[model samples]
Target chain A: MQIAILSGKGGAGKTLVAVNLVNLINLSTYIDCDVEEPNGKLYFSSEYNKKDINVLVPKINYKKCTHCNKCVDFCRYNALIDFLGKVKLLPSLCHSCGGCKLVCEFDAITEVKEPIGYIYQGDYKYHQIYGGELKIGKESGIEIISQLISKADKEKINIIDCPPGNGCSVMESIEQADYCILVSEPTIFGLENLKLVHELTTLYNKNIGLIINKANDYNNIIEDFAKTKDISIIGYIPFDKELAKLNSNQQLVSDNNKFKPYFIKIIEQIKQEVDL
Target chain B: MIIALPTKESGEKAFVSENLGRANYFYLYDTKTKEGKSFKNNFLNELHGAGVKTAEFLLKYSTDILITPRIGEKALEILLETDINIYKSTEKIARENINDFLNDNLEKLY
Candidate 1:
């Protein structure tokens, strides 16, 4: 079963939950799909086989051009602009639709592969982990996330750490899940964003449960909201100073006897729901 | 020579729009004939490349000068390549700014 851990807002402990879950499960494959700032790799000590994630972008061959300006008019992205009586192409703005190549009877435009990110595969303890990191300034990483999820070991249990927010990358990561775990903190902002995530998950028609991280005085806010929304509150990790310090030191708190049961309970809940 | 003025409205009362891409309308004034015509900036609502597309649209007028508040790099690049001179608009009023540019009172951007 493929399980995705996601949050509507960043720094809400989605990585904490996902990393802990993988450590506790021991046999599941962990895929970190947060390409923009993937921190899940920090918690694991493993050697990875790296692969570059590439996307096609248009390149102009001025030698083959007739200066007809058809490609400039055909480009919706404004990547091709009429410059100094010649057509100039901006690689960053090009979406690689191949429209310029199609419209150009002179065959001036051709597609070229551009590296957007890299995917890394390695094992952490007994479980395999896959992570993607986008090159700085790259706008999109859905393609990398999609490829990573597709390459998952279907027979083994998979836990995916999805990117934050309701953007395209988050949607792409969570869409392939057999079940979803929505992580949120105990704050008004957290509650509001969690509600948005809940609505999106419902739209996808997936079985979703909530994990309340940093549970403190603000627990009632999330508790009441989850009760009203009919969402199952699976686990709660209280705001503990020791746990935070341990996390900062790259220690797995799930290995501690005190915190192991909470993660184990979550696993039991999953096992009951799934045939794992 | 034609002068391109960024405007919020279509008539003589039109004020200069602060943003070139989001301008509601563009007033094209023919300096030789002393006649002005206004057209809606159709690319105003576009999500991306509005500035570049707006510059491309302005190309049809064969404008010799542009009077506006500010222009970004992408738009400036396109405008410079087309040999259109850019003049910064100090006044909020479109006609007054155009007069300043035509009278060599406003500062040229490039």
Candidate 2:
């Protein structure tokens, strides 16, 4: 089963939960889908084999071009432009949707491979680790995340650490998951954004659960919202200073006897929720 | 020479837009005819690349120069490749900038 860990707001402890959960689980594949700034690899010390990911972007053949502006008009990204007979392309803006190539009537456009990001594969103990790193100039890591997930072994349990926010990348990460764990904070900001991601999961019709991170007196808002939305509470990681210090020092809660039970309980609850 | 100003509204009372990409209207003033007109900028609401699309839209008018308070990097990239020269607008009113351009007072956008 694939479980996606996501949060609407940044710095809401999604990574903390994901790393701890992966370490506690029997044997699992952990995929860091936050290509722009993947932090999962920081906790897992391993020798990773890196691979490049490429996407096809359109290149115009000016000889056969009629300057009809069909490709320019078809590109919703506005990557294409025409100056009299000179056609200009801003390759970075291209989403590799191939609409421009399909719209060209004179066979003036052809696709060329462009490197967009990189995928890292490795192992930490009994678990497999995968990460996607988007190239510096690229905007969307959607393709990188897709390619990384495609490489995940379906035979084992997959723990996907999704990027923050309910945007395209987050949607892509959850699309293949059997269950989604929406992480939240105790603040009103967290509840509002949690509602956004919950609404998204509802829209996609996925099995959803919530984990209230940094639990304290302020958590009443998050609990009430979850209760109203009928979202199951998997488990809460207390806003304890020791846990934060250990986590900040790259120590896994699963490895420390003091905090192992917290994550173990979360795994047991997830197992029951998804029949794992 | 056909001069263009990124404007806030239609007609002579239209003020120059502070932004080049999401301007509400493009006011074109033909130097030979001493006549001006405003056309709605349909790319004003574009989520991204508004400047590039707006620049492409202005190409049809054969605009010799553009007057704006500021231009973004992406828009400036496309404009640099074209024959359209960008001029910095000193005033909020579109007519004042046009008069400045006619009197050689407005400076080229750096």
Candidate 3:
């Protein structure tokens, strides 16, 4: 079963939950789909095999071109335009549809592969780790996230750390996930973002559980939303200075005596829903 | 000669849009005839590549020169490909910049 850990915004302990869960589960695959800023590899460092993620962008052969606007009109992305009787192509905006080549009767268009990011695989302590890295200056990492998710080991219990927000990249990360774990903090901003993620999970019809970071008894706003949505509150990582200090140094706090119960308690609830 | 300027609206108070891509209207002035016309920027609502699209939209006017308060690299690249001489708009008012262009008071942007 694939479980996706998501947050409405960054720095909401999404990675903390995912990293601890993987360490406790042991013999599971950890796929980090946050290509833009994937730091999960730090906690699971080993000899990693890197593969480049590539996408095709159109290039125009200006020498053999006519002034026909068929290619420009056919492009839904508007990446191609007519300039001074010559065609200009914006590679960043191109979706690699290749319709421009198809519409070009003069055969003035071709595709070139551009390396946008990398897919890295490694293993440590009986856990398989995977990460996607997008190159600097690249506009979108949605493609890399999609390709990385496809590499997950289906047979092994997979725990995916999805990118933050309810955007295209986040949607791609959760496409095949069987269960969605929404993480939030105890603030109004966290509640608002969590609502969006909850709505998204409902739209995808996936079983969802909520983990409240820096949670306290007085955070009624976050508690109220989860109750209304009927989403089970699975776990909470309280606002504690010692735990934060230990986490920064130890990386994995699942084995620590204080945090073990909170991390372990959610396993039964997850298994019951996942197995069903 | 035909001149093109990115304008927020038509009339005396019409100012050059601070942003080239989001301009609501473009004012075209014919130097020989001394007549000006305003064309609605077609891609003002486009979420992406609006600046480049606006540059392409201006090609239909057979403009000889373009004066704007500011322009980005992508839009500047497209305009540079054509024969249009791009002049940096020194004045905020659309008509004053046209007068500035006529008087050769503006500097050419590479």
Per-model root-mean-square deviation over C-alphas: 3.7, 2.7, 3.0
Query: Per-residue lDDT for A34 in model 1?
Result: 93
Native contacts matched by each model: 0.33, 0.62, 0.48
Residue lDDT tens for model 1, A1-276: 799999999999998889998998758899999999888988999998999988887777879988899988888877887765677776656676888889989877788898888999998778998999988756678889998998778788899999989888888988878899999999999999998888889999989888899999889999999998898888899999988888878778898998888888888887766666
Ranking by lDDT, best first?
2, 1, 3
Q: Could you tell me the TM-score of candidate 2? A: 0.89
Positional deviation of residue A203's Cα in model 2 after best superposition, in angstroms: 3.3
Instruction: Give residue A181's error in model 3 in angstroms.
Output: 0.6
Candidate 1 TM-score, C-alpha based: 0.81
Q: Candidate 2, after superposition: displacement of residue A231 in Å?
A: 2.7
lDDT score of residue B45 within candidate 3: 88
Weakest ten-residue segment in model 3 chain A by summed lDDT: A267-276
Models 1 onward score TM values of: 0.81, 0.89, 0.87
**Chain B TM, cand. 1:** 0.94
For each candidate, the DockQ is: 0.32, 0.58, 0.52
User: How well does chain B match by TM-score in each candidate?
Assistant: 0.94, 0.94, 0.91
- Candidate 3 interface RMSD after superposing interface residues: 1.4
Candidates 1 and 2, the one with greater TM-score: 2
Pairs of residues at least 3 apart in sequence or in different chains that clash in candidate 3: none
